[model samples]
Target: MKQTQLCTLVKKSEPIKGVFDFTVEAPAIAAEAEAGQFLHILCGRGVFLRRPISICDVQDKLVRFVFEVKGEGTRELSEFSVGDKIDIIGPLGHGFYVDNEKYKHPAVIGGGIGIFPLLKLSQKLYEPLVVLGFRSADRVMMEEEFRAVSAKTLVATDDGSYGYDGYAIELLGKELMESECDVIYCCGPTPLLKAVQSLAAEKNIDCQLSLEQRMGCGIGACLVCTCKTTHEGMDENMRVCKNGPVFDAREVIL
Candidate 1:
């Protein structure tokens, strides 16, 4: 069920320079929330459009979300204090499908801020192997949290400042070749997603990607968040906020 409520901010943290992690007291939203769905948050009185942030996790009666300050809206959002009442409309959009029986061996990958949405997904999967990518060591976040849920956690950085001195997707490729991963769930920037898409295609593996698209109305009333896709030989524009933020790698035309 969709909710438009004045949720109270229960917790807040700054993991990096501009990145903010916030948890709100919204039991209704949390109860129905799933991995990959986003919250449409009205930053303040001056901000016209709501900022769509991915659902990072959901506890008993709290919903967690993380967002980097990219613009004025997000900057305002970051200024919110604990106990502040926030106007939010969410558990919006489609989320990743969790089917452990059909997918015996699963691997999950994420890069940059895209890593946030995969946390809850990792909790749902059956011992999913988690691989996270970053620009360098300082960019890495939430290693302990992922390790708590996943069978094993791997890290990679573009510079040799982290675990594996290469793209995390490359490490995933190596792991796939050496071990067995029947299904892959990935979320990242376009370049990273493209690489994972190609790698999954080459290995003939089933892959689902969570997209980061610019959205206007998080509920799909407008065309602001549409992405190119092909299904059954038919090319179409699909609303990321409605049809997906998650899709099969083969179907979404990256």
Candidate 2:
């Protein structure tokens, strides 16, 4: 069940250059939200389409989401101040599977804004290793937050501006070569996700991927957010909002 609520904005901050973090007072959504789930937010009047933002954290009666201002809708959301009421419908979408006890030493990897959903998953895992990638130092966000929840955290940048001087997947590949992990969990751009998926397969490691897609309705009724799936011996298109924003690496066509 989904509820539409006018949530009070509690805190808004730009942790990095263009990204905005919003914490809102929405006990129902927070209480029910799972890691990798997202909220459909009404930015403001005249913005016909609600923006889908992934849940970054859930604490007590508050839910936090981090997003980069990519257009007028997000720019309007960024302008909202504390005490403002933001209309939201959530916690929507199928989330990451965190209870598979088969995965012991899991590696959580994310890129750019994709790191947002992994935060809550990190909090639930038992000291999983975290790896994050950014285009440069100025684009990096959530290092300390991931560090707080992870046993170890690694950061990589495309340029040599911060941390390792390459893609985070390089670091992840090196880690896999050095040691063994039960599984790999990831969310990122299509290129990054593809690379991670390939690497995981090369190493014979179990992996799960969270996909990002343009969505019309946050629920499956719209049928806009679909991905190719082959999980149940059926090769078909699955709704990301209903079937998953997360899918097994082996089952998804990527």
Candidate 3:
């Protein structure tokens, strides 16, 4: 566990009202943290527990986290200013693994806040196709970033206020069947995950998924983020904060 200062803040979106991007100075964690690892951050003084957020990006001396201020803790985080010091412990959970050869032409599917984590993965994909979903045009984000990294980028809005007029999976599903993509990765709502799982099954395609769960310990110790999987066996409870925030698509029940 390590404690650090909230070095800076970058406001990346006006789309989702309370979302903000935080850039913290955590050289040690950044040195060891991989693309899919997450951080457990405490945004305020005397907060009982920290919030587990995915590590958005990691570089030489900094780690980034893109978060939505959905509740009290995050709301508190939103108020923090530059040079404010906060308690943080992490590079906590497991992350998505990239197999450039096997995933030559890969596709990333993200929904709402879920899109945040996928951005890091895009940096590693050789030629990626990113499909992001939002409720409306006002909610859409990261289009330019995806355009910058991915070979092809598509955006979909539930209400047709942005890119395509449909759900992300619907658009991605159609595109997956028609494209020469070798693998798929996704992070989204439960229903969307189910749909992606079903489609991947039908195609016998390899897919990886990142899960979001309420957590206590951002490490494996508390087992707070336990999830079912069929990977190594039929009855196994995997810890999301440890074993993965990322998993093989077919292995996860959802």
Candidate 4:
């Protein structure tokens, strides 16, 4: 199910420079939202296309999302006040696997803003080992939130300004050397995902990846957000907005 609604902005904050975190009073969207899904937000400043923002978490009748002001659409979105009604369509796209019974231990890894969607996933996993990466310590956001849900939370910074002086996947690799992770869920830049995919393949671990793509429509109607995918040895392209933002690492051609 999907919907286009005027969601009220109930909460707003700037976690870091150029990044906005908001929770909207969208009962309809919140009721059905799942981890890894996204919202297509209508930015009103002459921006014709809707912007896709990842779902951070859903609490009761509110749905939370975090987005960086990379361009005009996002910049306008950031300027919205607490009482404004924003047009949005969501609880959209396929989300990560939520069944945790079969797996004893699972790991969730993300870098920079990609870490947003993995929050709900970590909460759902009960006690996933979470590794998140950022450019520097000052740029890091929501460490305490992840810490509250995850059994152990590790932070990595590129310039050695934080916990570990390397990429997040590297920290995940170190953890895997000791811990028994039955499955892994990751989202980030292309390079990070590729590395994680390789690491998972080498260790023979099951893994899922959330891909990022430029989207025109939040639904399957537009073909702008397609990504290379393979299934049963057959190669094809799948829409990131509909078919998946989440896919098995082995099935994704990336």
Candidate 5:
């Protein structure tokens, strides 16, 4: 629970009009942060609860996060300048559990804001075939970053202004059909997750999911971000902040 400075706020795209990319400063957190871990953030002083954001890209001495300015807290976060600092507590929650040998030629699927966490994961997991879905061409983010790490990348837009003129799932199916991947991992809206889950189950491919749940405490103490899952033999409710923001696709009911 360390307080840090808001170092850089750069707009990545005019995508979705007001969304911005904030490359923040938190060396201590960055040093220890993992691929699927997230940072708990508080934009203004009076906001009692902090917002949980997935870690984006972390370089030496700095950790970055890309967020859409959906509300006042994020809007306020967008207003910070290079040197301005904010109170940030992270890297919270359990990260993605990726198999080193089994995940060779893994395919990653991300839609809209869900792409945030995968960006960091891609940096570590080299050359994954990535599929990103956006509302339009302008709303798209982080194409270049994917190119740096991914062996193959595909983009889909609702209005057909991008790489593929359809949903991300379309591209995902295509990627799966065209290539033989060892495993699959995905993050996005509930519908997209459901679709991916179904696909993974049908295909008999190992899959992992990162869940986005509302939180009171970024850690497990408050039981706010609970999800249903079957661990060993019984069904149980687990807190996302502590037990996992990441889980095996088969373990979760979804």
Candidate 6:
């Protein structure tokens, strides 16, 4: 179940040039939040619709979310100061399923801001391999956090400004060929997700992907955040906010 509450902003940080990380006091949401879940945050007064931000981390009575200042909604959210009360509804959406025993050696991969949710996932998956990608060195964020939880970590930047001078998928593909991982968990831009999906399929590895989509209502009613699914012999649309932000890579039409 989800709850609406006025969460108090307890801490904030700018991990990168434009991205903001917020830790809020929301015990109810924190208690139930799972990796890959998100929060529907009411971004101040003028922004009527809530912005859906992925749950980045959860501690005793606090939940954290990170966002880049993309528009008015997120821009307003960034200006909020400590002790400000913000209305939020969460631990929303279906999350990544963590079955360590089933997927013995899993590789967790993400690109850009998509890496946020995977942080929580890495904490859950014991010593999973992690791969992260960024457009350049300035855009890179959270290298140490991922390294703390992962057995091995690889980073790639498109511009050759930092880490490997190539796409992160290239590193993932190389690793897949060299070693054996039972499954893969990934989230990122559409193109990256597609590449990862194709690679996973080629290798016959089970994979799961978390999708990002524009949303109106954070719940299922609005139908704004729909993605095609190939389940139950039907090629129908599924709600990203409700059915998932997470799904088996094979079940989605992306």
Query: Per-residue lDDT of 101-144 in model 5, one digit per residue for the tens?
Result: 66778888998899989988887774688888888988888888
What lDDT score goes with residue 80 in model 1?
96
Residue-level lDDT tens digits of model 3 in 173-218: 8897689877888898888888888888888888888999999877
TM-score of 1: 0.98
Deviation from truth (RMSD, Å), model 5: 2.2
Candidate 6 Cα lDDT to native = 0.93
User: Which regions of candidate 6 are displaced past 4 Å?
Assistant: none
Write down the lDDT of every candidate, Cα atoms only. 0.92, 0.92, 0.82, 0.92, 0.81, 0.93
TM-scores for candidates 1 onward, in order: 0.98, 0.97, 0.93, 0.98, 0.92, 0.98
List model 1 lDDT by residue over 1-254, tens digit each.
Answer: 46688999999999888899999999889888989888999998789999889999999999999988999999999999999999999888889998999987889999999999999999999999999999999989999999999999999999969899999988998898788888999999999999999999999999999998988988888899999999677999999999998998999998
By lDDT, the better pick of 1 and 2 is 1
- Report each candidate's C-alpha RMSD, comma-separated, in the order given: 1.0, 1.0, 2.0, 0.9, 2.2, 0.9
User: Candidate 2 has what TM-score?
Assistant: 0.97
Full-model lDDT, candidate 3: 0.82
Off by more than 4 A, model 3: 1-16
Task: For model 1, state the Cα shift of residue 49 in Å.
Answer: 0.4
Candidate 4 vs candidate 6, lDDT winner: 6
